[model samples]
Target chain A: MSFLAQSAAANPWFSWAYLRTNADTIRALVVEHLSFTVEAVAAAVVIGVPLAVLAYWVRPLSGPILASAGVLYTIPSLALFAFIAPFLGTGRLTVLIGLVLYALLLIIRSTLTGLSQVPPDVREAASAMGYGRLARLLRVELPLALPGLVTGVRLATVSTVALVTVGVLVGKGGLGQLIIGGFRNNFYKAEIATGAVLCVALAVLLDLLLAGFGRLVTPWRRERA
Target chain B: MNSFNQMINWLNDPLNWTNPDGIVTRLLEHLRLSFGAVLLACLVAWPIGIALGRRGRGGGLVVVLSNATQAIPVVALLTILPLTALGFGARPVIVALAVFAVPPLLATAYTGMREVDPDVRDAARGMGLSRWQLLRGVELPLAVPYLAAGLRTATVQVIATAALAALVNGGGLGMIVSAGFGIGIAAGGGQILAGGLLIAGLALLAEALLAWVQRRVTPAARQT
Candidate 1:
């Protein structure tokens, strides 16, 4: 008992000290998560936006494509990881595939809604000005749809950050490692504190960034008021 | 020829249905966990969601909390929660899954309430309904459709995430997939595939059931 008390006294704030000492790990984890999220969200936008555009143009296939993506969204993250592991191997590639698929539903739906919400009059005016389909979409439609698209991107970023934590299970790196390591070692303060800090920090940072992005993209929102 | 016939016979075997630990039993366990998590999430999030929706604008704090809680990965949340507590098992798994369900529920509820037309709210107030009465009679009914949509999303997500509970020694069909991966059985691939298929089927069933409920509960005038 004396020895235990001595040990506790010797390192009264051991967990905090340990976390501070491993600040490099925490920084690395944050960097890694942010990079992965950006990559995945970017890939999702590239693929999902085109698919959404195609679905909209094709009309008939939109329902089926959206439905399929919705169903894909229902696959548990771990299960999807497991399913993809056979083909992609259990590393960054597998994690990337899962994140991309997860983002697809949100991004695609957003793109479709954004594009469709462009006023018919705007499109007609663009056509009357002799603008082609591509020109109209680039100038008239996309700008109008920017708010909704940004909203989707913001949501997708949140999802990506959350889901990236799952990559820890397959030996990909993140703050998840700290949380998982802390748990395995039966260190309550360390585990909960680390998880709580990372979660809260990431959420606040992302929300602020997205809100700023929204404000930038939707000047009309400010002008209207 | 004999091996091929045996394989066919194995596929055709009735023993598949009557096995001591049958597929149906595993499915029931999965459903129980999924439903339990959803219920817990609804219990925790509904009041907060309703309040946030009614108040509007100031709900950013709740949204932040919900999003942060959600961003804590299921495996991490399950693993970490139990460390602070004792006897890590299904309880932690359920808590983590419930946390996962909360955000969508809250977001949906808040959006639903906020989306209630201001004109309608003004009319309700003009009719001399108290705030609570207006909420109960007008806002809630209108918000129900959106709430249902959010719940539907939550249900599907919860079911999917519940499969991960097996990682924390909370057995479900995920056990089959995990175990199959452990042994690396080419034959065990079938079990993993089967488990995946089962989850997909359950998700579809849940979606259909929720859609039906949404349609049934929503007033015909507001069907659009």
Candidate 2:
């Protein structure tokens, strides 16, 4: 008749003894983790790509933008989480801001490198065909830059997956809740191993998936240096 | 303004500084752990990197291993390592940080050596340079800048991550930060702000110092 007993009865995975405080809530936690990774990486790409292009074109702003991102990237996961928690009050927003900041430098740097790595002749030819700056950037340069862009995405996603565990400190990071739970319970193997193993497994799965996706999108990356 | 004042207030408190568990001691412990990890990582990664580069055969392996290791979140590693005989304190955290630090270091060293000019290598061989001599006289020197740069990146990363040591009795500014957060966000804001400021300042300082070292060790002639 009680809510706790009812939920425990309903869900086979739910147990009162060990993961009582939502510890073994594996399904919801995993979903939260995935969304955290996806949302953060998506935002980074959306914001970072345009900023990178603007930096490239504007020239004067490039150094500062890249430098600031680099500095932001150096802030530790937990430290950043703590700083943001007070402001955002935890949950997805804090995680999102932390991950976006972390990924920005990599995304911007790679986009710049990937665009620059394309031989000048390719651009000249595109221009000769009357491709405007915007068209050439999208059609010619962007495709060629796909390899680096994909690589950035791959790194960001994997790192973000790992970092989401830190969110446990604030009660919002996906796998982290289980991890901290285990830690507090004196390294209960089921809780600790399940959380750690699951987190590592998820990160690797995402990384491989992204790598495969990268190869599919940028076939030229494999064919060349 | 209030929070900022509180931070200064917390920081200014002499009581916060007097204990063995004070920020000063914690900072020292953090430095020791971070530097130990980076040094250990360099010892392991650079040699392996050099060997792989010499044979021109292991960049793929580095990428795979790095990605795999990177995927393991530091928090998980921090918690799990203690479950093993690694015990607690700094050993496991040091190992974990080193594992995390190895990627950039190995990747850069391998790439640096591999990217050396083919013509330069051939000329060295033609000049009858011995294998060891060629490595020392040419390849190793060429890789120094790249190695330094990699070390800088890895070191900065390691220093920042070292803060997490506080989570598991491994003392650092993280002790202050985590304690603050644990005390509840609003009430603990001062401690968190003070700790956060110190860690951020330390990270930036490490970046600048290492960048200087990277710039200096890179031979002037390698500027091109």
Candidate 3:
């Protein structure tokens, strides 16, 4: 029943020691946290990328589709999770679906922006080279748009990782389980801080990993810079 | 379909509005928490953003840093912060919401200010305008749309995240939501839906208001 700050106020000396004793448990929680993040981001990309392409290919559909996605994004995460529990039974499925939906608007917006902003002259040159629409999009537009796509995925990855803790409401919380445990223990500061710190670290690590991938794919951009 | 009917019944119930934990009070509380967070976020983030935008040194670092911050889940923050000296209450809720709120707002202000036409800035400088005068007469006006857009984004996000306050000791529309699920299946489902819908409605309304403000500010931002 140790509440972190309250006890920290009393005995700040042993916080690290507390974390040390729980190292193995923290490691396991981090692994679980990563898995939840990956699955959700993967699901978001599967749905979001194609939707982005569709919005690009069909100009008329873009506004409404993007608007709908924006509206969906505005729904608070806790409410959205609770909203679905009736159907999904408060498991990982409910949280995963919410994560996927939350990721879509950011992914689609980035994808559309990246794809659309490909220089018109470059597109014209592609056509002059006798490249058809699909071919031009696949080769020219897609590669040129890599920065935006990379940015989108990077943001989504971190967001998904952060949100994995929220799944505790449904008993699928990864690092969030610790936070819930902390509360149940009457504000066990060390427990909650450990979970929160790990969550932040996971987010940073995932973002850096994706940024590396972005760099690997867009090596030419570095030369330009 | 059956659940929808039940949700409607729950909405129709008089006590849902008349009780101390009624929709009206909760909505007001939600607005207050959201407003408090956004105000604090703007105060903290905007000046630093404007300063950084003037210098243009930290864009790359901030973009990466913000990505990292954005990923820290609201639930974790709510719970963990309570364990801090800030203990559970409206204060911790505002702190968490504002922390998350800062990124988008700061980014928008910085970008907006940065994107003002270089020639416009040069001309103002040529006029022997002091830095303050130039910022007021030139950059700030040109940066309106960008800053407004950022404000909108931050406000919407703060409002949305504020719903998580219910998980802590704070009260808002989330009370209905978290309480519903805690209560059970039938009654809880209906209450959750009502609460969820109300929160969603508030988000959309705030977004629309901000979007209009962004558009309204455009006269000051003459396109180069």
Candidate 4:
């Protein structure tokens, strides 16, 4: 056999047959990553949106809070994971906490930006119409800011998906297992191909989903198009 | 005299510098990895980013791609790449870092190009400039500020994520952290804390440098 064939034969992970045979495994991996991503992102939105609203209302704390989030963003994922592991222990919970923390900066920034983008005059007019604080927020400010908030969600979604892979390191679920296992076993082709496929597919799917959502939520953007 | 002597003793500690696996060495390695990744990413991403930006037809698509790429967990990517390539080292780490770097560069470049004032483009076209000339002379110059901002974001991200390279045994400041955590800090908590601070300082320095470069390169006209 030729050297290429020899190399391919030697590497189980790289074989087309291996990937084909492991279809069920790959699906499970993808599902786990997706579920974890969704969960973390949802948690982040829950925590982040309120903080964003409070920060926006308060104004003074926004800068500091956002800055601190920015600092958190700078902390490396592995290091963050390691740091939090001491307090949270290993597994999905630790990964979730880290992902949630990571998501906060982007979500908060976008939330603030979205809310602030609503014209002051529009807000004043809403108040003149006797809209209560909650009413004005839900009916006017939120709807106006929905596009940006959605953008933030879109960002958080992609980030969480990507981050869930990191969950593999802490003995949680996802494609990270495939990656880590493949590496430890010296399976180069399987490792590279698996990573490449997942990254590309996840990226494409997320873009399509977010674009669709953006269109649905922001008819004005569509009209402009 | 006793207080002065205590202060002097603190300054002379071996932990301050001379250890072979010192914080300074680890910090340098992390910075080196981050810089290597960013440079590689720029080399790969910039041309593509510029092309996509100039095209302007699929700006949203590019943004989505970048955002998605950015979102992928670093550990996951690191884990997979090395496995495919067989065994772990700096190459896989660099590849992971580069992959992470691409989205921001491409998105920002695309956005910058798209956000260029239509009037400016029209004026350039009106002056009988060809498409290539219009892109080089009018569109690109206008898009630089936004592009710089995007690069600034990418720079910090690359620096931060490069720390993950340690998980794969790629060796960087993360080694200090992971090793410290593995052994428990009582054995070397000082080393780990020092490494963490070093990483933080390097990140700050990178942010400052990139910001400075952005400010310096950006035209005075764009400053407002």
Candidate 5:
């Protein structure tokens, strides 16, 4: 039997030959996965922060805003993608929109909670120091809320990475394509393992990088720690 | 709009309910899988979390681990597991979902146990309550809301991810959606939309029900 046929029969979990042959495909998939994740999360933050600000500014809106996000979050990843694919035509945009919706609840809740946690006295101090509301929010509240916001970003980023794999159902599932493809390709164990491992590693690596970024931005936290 | 009407018409068809691969069967299968996974996860995570919480240690690790597990794509796990000797069935789906569920359940249980007010605990201890009495009477009651919240999160997550079971030859509502996809978009768009709608509706219903339960269980002081 040829190596491919032999490996298919044996179904080994690790095959150097498979990796060597599929290296370019795997690299492209990984890049696709990373880009999808980064873009989705960045978009979610852009949209989520303003919504969080709106919720914070208008106390009545908070309930509706958070509740809507919660509802969106409850929708299954597959269903969310399915719902949008008809309109978006089953590719990057559909996946991106679904991911942003999923990430919103986490980001909004964290940002709002972080902003709320900023002490009233500190706000008064900022105001007393001749700061306007926007200035206070930017200089005092946001600075103080950095840890929580960063934590939310990390959570959103990680979850987005996982959900991006669901895009495979629509032909945009980055590493997810490899995972499902391996399964359909005669239970190719090495391919499935490689895809799964890379996804998890990517999640962990990005989370750590975000954590580092969080620490770097909030130098005062370092001193306290 | 045309697709929406078709979806409505598809949902209304009597045969769709009574057929072998009908909505009712798929729904029941989905519910069964979700319930089993969540139950198994609770069994595995609750005891360990409670023990750690009571000790007031390992909470940080539990939190970190829980957050880390959020990164694990359920689809990947579902597909990867059946490749083992488990081999293409509900068994691997259940096992994968259970693993997916452990983190939130475990983390919440730990937090619930740890969040009991220290002063209340001290008062209970001073009143000559044994460790057992303290746990049962004081800590557990206070922890109910947190446990409920954790249960809610786990159930919702499991239900959503359980849809992927169809990919592994595991029975669930996912099979409906997958079947719809198999027929191609032009002919099967209505079926696809219907399946997606059903799954989304089921998940939302579960979320609302659990949120109500969480509210009911919470101490009145903590209702907000």
Candidate 6:
């Protein structure tokens, strides 16, 4: 094994040769990584937005709701996966659940913050203009809260991207599998570097995409800027 | 239920506590690595953070850079480092953990320092306090809560990520979980469950302890 590793070390760390041959594998991994991230963040938004709305409506529930989400975020990824794998099985489904759980706090907190920070006068004016409570929340509050919501989504998305690699421990690590494969294959630098680079690149790309989405949605803010 | 009972039995086992690779030894290793990483991160990040916060400039750049680092996976870093000159040992793991730890430490320290009330700072200046005196006497005290909060965040994150050390020949509770993985889950599932519980429990305990410290350090007026 040592001899093999020594020989592998002789291979260049950044090789077009490796890239060309492994292009298909890298593409598949990137797709898996992207899909997992999108699915997890989407699920988190679907679940978290309602919870945040509930917390916003019921003042007392906010504390417990956010606190519990915080607890979920605090659990180490590996431990969380291990704990859940028995019940959920070590697969994409388990990883998806874990990702969503980790993302809940960030999404909820940001959305709650965004909702709370809406100008009271704006809300009053909305009411005066015959907007009901639900209408005010849906039209006036949610739109104004777009920046904060976007920030939360960006944060959660980036974090989830990083975390998906940990899923490799359960055979669902997306790009993480390549990283581990590299390790077991005598520290194949090209494979490890590719996986790591792609992961970071994915994060940056998603963050920028979210930022663009935020700007695209908040046109009035753009004029001010 | 069976697995939970198995985990409990595993924890209760005397051999798991006293043997060479027992829980106690792994726990110590985890704590030591976590401490070293956080300390190193503090040493590297605090001075830069404090200076920037004091001057109240360059902080936006610092924040952006730190935020960028968040996207880099810890597991990837842990794996990559061992392939370098660092080789397989606690050093690479410590280095990776410290790197992961720096962003929170730096961000919080800068924010803590930057958040010092200008009025208080002006009063200190009016009293003819030197810059260093103002920082030590007024700013640092006021920033304690932020610093403590940052420390807590960094420490918890370090402790959590330190479990990845097992991937690179580093000693820690992760070794147990990975060991369980080495055998199949049917036979070694108890060890995996036990390891997860222990790791999560330790992280939560550290978080709670540090939160208490944060509360204590916060001034009465800022208690909320």
TM-score of each: 0.80, 0.87, 0.88, 0.76, 0.94, 0.95
Rate residue B170 of model 4 by lDDT. 75
Error of 5 at B206 (Å): 1.0
Candidate 6 RMSD to the correct structure: 2.0
lDDT of 3 by residue, A20-131 (tens): 8888888888888888788888877789888998999999999999999987888878778877877767777888888888888988999899999998999999999999
TM-score of candidate 4 relative to the true fold: 0.76
| Clash list (residue pairs), candidate 2 | none
State the TM-score of the second chain for every model: 0.84, 0.92, 0.93, 0.82, 0.94, 0.95
Clash totals, every prediction: 0, 0, 6, 10, 1, 1
DockQ versus reference, model 3: 0.62
Q: Which of the numbered candidates is closest to the native, going by highest lDDT?
A: 6
Interface root-mean-square deviation for each candidate? 3.7, 1.3, 1.5, 4.7, 1.1, 1.1
- State the lDDT of candidate 1 residue by residue for A164-183, as single tens digits: 87775466746666665665
Best by DockQ: 6
Clashing pairs in 4: A159-B71, A162-B72, A162-B73, A163-B73, A188-B84, A188-B85, A188-B86, A191-B84, A192-B84, B66-B103
lDDT string for model 6 (B1-224, tens) is 46677788888999998899999999999999999999999999999999998888988878787788889999899998877798788888889999988888888889988888899989999999999899889988888888898899999999999987776558898888877767767766788899888899999999999999999989879887
> What's the candidate order when arranged by decreasing lDDT?
6, 5, 2, 3, 1, 4
Model 3 C-alpha lDDT per residue in residues B1-224, reported as the tens digit of each score: 55567779889999998899899899899999899999999999889889999898689866865765786778877776665788667888889899988999889888987898889989999999999999999999878888888899989888888887887748988888877878875657888778888888888889889888877877744532
Choose the strongest candidate by TM-score.
Answer: 6
Alpha-carbon error at A92 in model 5, in Å? 1.5
A183, model 5: CA deviation in Å?
0.7
Candidate 2 deviant stretches above 4 angstroms:
A1-24, A215-225, B112-142
**Candidate 5 CAPRI assessment class:** medium
- Each candidate: RMSD to true structure? 4.9, 5.0, 3.4, 5.9, 2.2, 2.0
Docking class of 4: acceptable
How much DockQ does model 5 earn? 0.73
Instruction: Report the C-alpha displacement of residue B214, candidate 3, in angstroms.
Output: 2.2
Candidate 6 docking category?
Answer: medium
